[model samples]
Target: MTVNIPQLRAFLAVVEAGGFSAAAADLGMSQSAVSHAVASLERELAAPLLVRSAPVRPTALGERVLPYARTALTAVRSLEEVAADAAGAMTGTVRLASTPTVSQGLVPQLLRHWREELPRITVRGFEGDSAEVAQWLENGTADAAILIDPPPGPGVQLALDGYRALLPRDHPLAGEAAVDIRDLADDAFLISPNGCEARVREIHRLAGVPFAPAHRVRDLATLISMVQAGIGVTVLSEVSRPLVPCDLVLLPVEPRTSRRLVLSGPRARRWHPAVRALAESAAGRLAAVS
Candidate 1:
């Protein structure tokens, strides 16, 4: 049976918007029109696609069909745009997944360059932990990922970046030219919620000391805030140092813990031009900061 686009749109709208009237409002059609479209879709498929209630719920058949409908619509839109671009036209979509700290710190600079250099390319950003970033890249949810301490995965490319230590300006170690991991062993540790635990533990193990975190934070901003409040000192990549406000001093850490910023995709060379461009730009930016 031929499924109509209008009917599919209405069905997806109701599934997204929860009720017939809300979907109608969003689609700028009357509630009756929305209802009729869903009915037509159900009739054509010879099944009840949705359960009518206070909030409309999708039937098993509806659940099965919804993703296909969404994917078809997305593919159609992408193809139409690609056709409009034709040959020699630089235009496509690039989805990037990165850790939250990088998302708040390094991504803005990269995105600024991307918008200027490739305005036609659509960019989507996902912020998560290293594990989540790696999962998205492996599962094909993201075209590329920026991560710290990412797990070993096939097709992943890694770049070594410099490190920074977040400490209160008045702290004794702040007066030193550079702080060493061993010097801070006695100090309370403030750790990044993601990947920091493992990295810190490894650093302690190497220093022959046991590591314990005094505070754990998910966001770079929060981690800096905690450090500024004298909660504890934490180490972060140099790229994230700029994200912290001036009230907190980010000192260079000596014998720096080498941090890896990983970039992964289905294939490094086969990535979309926009994705490749952004990845190169990110690497360059990090290198300059380092």
Candidate 2:
């Protein structure tokens, strides 16, 4: 039985788009044509591949088959490019997503170095919290991601870093060598909005205090801004401290609450060479900051 490239492409498109009509639009075909192709694929495989409900979800068989199809497609595309490169070629784009801290601090340095070393490889970065970064990797919107406190599962590479407290310049704790979480329990707390509240809760738990947040903001910049304004104190990764405004002081948090950073993609080590290169370069820059 011969595998049909068109059928496979159609199935993968449907899975990516989540509906036949959307997939058809993406593939430049009619909805009927997309439906026929998926049906043909299911017939050839002797199993139902898609669960055709409102959103048109993939079945377990489809989920298992989808990754292989994507891998095969990526390989085929790379082979075609290599063949074309027999004459001359050096350019490609690597799409990456990262948390705001990595995006603001580390990525710029890595991009500068990457441009000097691999002029042909362009690094395009998207910024979000950890959850958004993970979602981008899972949905194929990103070729790779630098995520903080990534949810546990397969297809992730863990990188660890320590946290520090951000305090206003005039705040009394700024003069301390290292302030423990318990030292600040009575103080008003500034926290990163919803997605990162867990980190604050962990700090409170470690300090044996209730996790009460007086204010919450979505990113480090905002949290630090609030700190500088004397709204409240918050803890964040050391990597993020540099990006905070100059008026704020970064102090080591005692007993050390650590942040786990993870680099993740669908293929892990099998990632595109450009992606791997960028990941390594970014890791080096982050290590230096740590």
Candidate 3:
């Protein structure tokens, strides 16, 4: 089978974007072109890859072949980077994923550092909840990701920010230097399910406090707004302090708890050269500051 890079790219884009039109927009090609590429790929392979439904899902064969496709594309990108690196000017786009808080708090600085270190590499940002960010990295949608509490291997530790108790200005515990989770048990507890819920729950569990949150908010902004309006109190990372309104207070949990933020390339495939460069840049920055 003579499967070309364009056909592989078109297939992956279609799967990632969910439809030909969206894939075309992402790939900067016409819809017809994307369709022709995939069709040609199918013809060459002599099997249907996609089911072509409302959102366009992959068939069983497509599912099995997708990982190999990603591997092939990653390898090709690495080859291109090899040539660029030889000329001393690396150029490519690396899609980086992160949670909402990390995106807001750390991504700007990280991007700036990367730009200064690897000027030719364009790093695109993808923000999602923890699960979605992890999914993007696994599914080849992202070349690298800032993973929270990632497994210990093949990644750089970016930052370690502790989770803090969020309280309203007028709340009694708000003035304390460090508030115990048990101290706020009487208040209507709020939590965001975005990425930090498990950590929050673990904090509560360790403190012997109930883990039931009165409000399970999805958006970080809305959760902070709720706390500001005296709807309830919550716990969030210290990194999220900037997102909290001034009226809401963030106090260190009495027994401080922190989460590790790591930056790493895809777990399933070879690291794109730009991703490797980005990780090295971040590590060097951290080492310099330390």
Identify the candidate with maximal lDDT. 3
Q: Give the whole-model CA lDDT for all candidates, comma-separated.
A: 0.73, 0.74, 0.87
lDDT of 3 at 125: 83
Looking at candidate 2, what is the lDDT of residue 258? 75
Q: Give the TM-score of candidate 1.
A: 0.68
Candidate 3 Cα outliers beyond 4 Å, as residue runs: 28-33, 39-48, 52-54, 135-139, 267-270, 288-290
Enumerate residue pairs that collide in model 2. none
Model 1 residue 126 lDDT score? 72
- Residue 189, candidate 2: C-alpha displacement in angstroms: 0.4
Q: Per-residue lDDT of 96-133 in model 3, one digit per residue for the tens?
A: 99988999888999989888888988988877888889
The numbered model that scores best in TM-score is: 3
Q: In candidate 1, what are the lDDT values of residues 1-290, reduced to their tens digit?
A: 87888898799879867899988876779999999999999999999999998799999999999888776655554464456445645566777888877787667777887788678877777777777777756544566777665557533334565676778888888877788778887778888767456665666677676677887777667777888888889887777766777767777775557677776554422455556555665556666667
* Cα-based lDDT at residue 191, candidate 1: 84
lDDT of 2 by residue, 1-290 (tens): 55677888899888767899988876779999999999998998999999998788999999999988777766665674565366454456676788777776666766787788678887777777777777767656566787776667433343456778888878888889888888887788887774456765777777777877888787566677778778888887777755878777788886667776676665433455566555666556656667
TM-score of each: 0.68, 0.65, 0.85
